[model samples]
Target: MSTITYYLDMQRPEQIIGKPLPADLSVVECQHKQYQLNRFLYQLVGEPWQWTDKLSWSDAQWRALIEQPGHRTWVAYYQGAVAGYYELLRDAEGVVEILYFGLAEAFFGQGFGGPLLTQALQSAWAWPGTTRVWVHTCSLDHPSALANYQARGLRIYREEVEAEAP
Candidate 1:
């Protein structure tokens, strides 16, 4: 098997198509750098998609990433329940990357992906000195993941395919 990774980017905030969040769904930035919370969210929303890069990370490793000055997390709540989340990281070059994004297993197919992604893009652009916003998604992700990113005005800048060992 092979995994295909697509790199996408938006040169300007105006490029975003922007979707309005549903009344019952709201997203808010996590004001605290709680590694445990981020770890929980990673496992919760990434389970079905096979996200395992951080599965073996130690507490210190998680803390280091979460505590980075340019790292930020935002969670989406649906009717007061944790529905989804996204993480943004800005480099010194003024580029913001949507490092992680997804809906919880219980929230899939509920029309929340687009709006949540819109929030991600908007929030990325809101960062001071943001010159570009970007993200990457692979074939192992949700089928609509790439579509949703494109619908939000992110254009494909690169792609890669890697063979998976059995």
Candidate 2:
């Protein structure tokens, strides 16, 4: 399959504000728990093409990636069950990337996506020395992915088509 991916970035922290989450929904940082993080990644991005990056990694490699400094994952909970997650990676140069973001199938269409994304973006901006925040979404992602990022104030800065192995 081939995908046209859009890359987005926000250069100013003041450009967006976090939207309020439903009372029952909460976001928590995943604390060095590789197994749980892997499980969430698989379940949340279960659609075939959506999770290929991490799915193809060996256990050790996956753990090493997650353990790297400035790489963090946040899991969202709805009434205490895992609902979704977003991972962020910050490079030494002060650029933050929304490495991955998605909701599990069970949480889809429940109206939690926007708020969860808002939280993710807000958190990214809060990191010290962050000069920019960015994310990429392709055709293979959830239908609302790009729109959600735009709604949260990320603007498309570039896009291109690329082939993906089936």
Candidate 3:
């Protein structure tokens, strides 16, 4: 595959502000902050896989996430429609949080997640009283996710490398 380079700014998620893709790929704001968090948690809590299950969502659920503070949502438009989404939130402690992030597979390897993540980290590094930055991922359920986290320079502070499903 040829080299694909995508650009995104750390201070402004709006810079990318791609229009929602019209095809199967599209990004949208979460109905609620909790639902927004759930988007990142597909593997966790036994939620249906966005990629495998056609990724259907309820509009009512999305509206609630939009009302919360410290929650930011933006959809990726592929071919003029929303294809994927990235969310960023901050806790009372002032640590920049990667609350939930998802992208249509078509957008991967084209330079989306990496820059968005890098910018999130950059935002965290720039924040005051932020001593450390981190993200939570599993080694077994989602192997690629762990690799991606490492690639983003997030250290593994906790590990359950062999947690058998209950």
Candidate 4:
């Protein structure tokens, strides 16, 4: 599995990147100049649930995301192994929202994504002066990710089509 390092991007919606993890699950911050393509992978990979960057990513794309603001990324380490990753961003009102997220494909369904998400959400929500959070996934009747959010206490306030891409 690939391990991603995080660095802060200060362009638009500022964020903390990398936020690395150590062998025993300790967290550290990472700073690098390459672009990370996890978001692009989520946007262009296989089906929604099975979607990911299942290809060898190039250096240029990864570096661009590193330089983009309002984006954050992090990798989880379990027993010295790179286990998964996720990112968050804040809205204009200072509420943290999930921007991109995924676990190592091999770690799927082994009970990792949920806890990792739980931990990340807590960290985001705990940020001072933060308020409600909202994340939108497919609203075309696919329910797994939505269900997970509801189970976690995120009320589905409204249902709508995918937000137009920029």
Candidate no. 4 TM-score: 0.57
Model 2 segments more than 4 A misplaced = 163-166
Where does candidate 4 have its weakest 10-residue lDDT segment? 4-13
Strongest candidate by lDDT: 1
C-alpha lDDT of residue 24 in model 2: 94
lDDT of candidate 1 over 1-166, digit per residue (tens): 8999999999999999989999999899999889999999999999999899999999999999999999999999988899999999999999999999999999999999999999999999989899999999999899999999999999999999999988
User: Residue 121 in candidate 2 has what lDDT?
Assistant: 86
Residue 37 miss distance in model 3 (angstroms)? 13
Ranking by lDDT: 1, 2, 4, 3
Q: For residues 1-166, what per-residue lDDT tens digits would candidate 3 score against the true structure? A: 2222122112322222232223444444554456544444433322323233314656565545545675565555657844455566666765556655555555555555555555455555555655445555443223355555556656555443343455
Which scores greater on lDDT, model 1 or model 4?
Answer: 1
State TM-scores per candidate. 0.97, 0.89, 0.52, 0.57
lDDT of each residue in 98-166, candidate 4, tens digit only: 665555555556555556656566666665656655565554323355555555555555554434455
* lDDT agreement of model 3 with the native: 0.48
Taken over the whole model, the C-alpha lDDT of each candidate is 0.96, 0.83, 0.48, 0.51
For candidate 2, lDDT tens digit of each residue in 55-128?
66677887777888988889898887888888889999989999878888888899898999898888898888
Residue 37, candidate 1: Cα error in Å is 0.4
Error of 1 at 56 (Å): 0.8
Give Cα distance to truth, residue 100, candidate 4, Å. Answer: 1.1
Model 3 residue 160 CA deviation (Å) reads 2.6
Which runs of model 4 end up more than 4 angstroms from their true locations?
Answer: 1-34, 37-65, 68-70, 139-143, 161-166
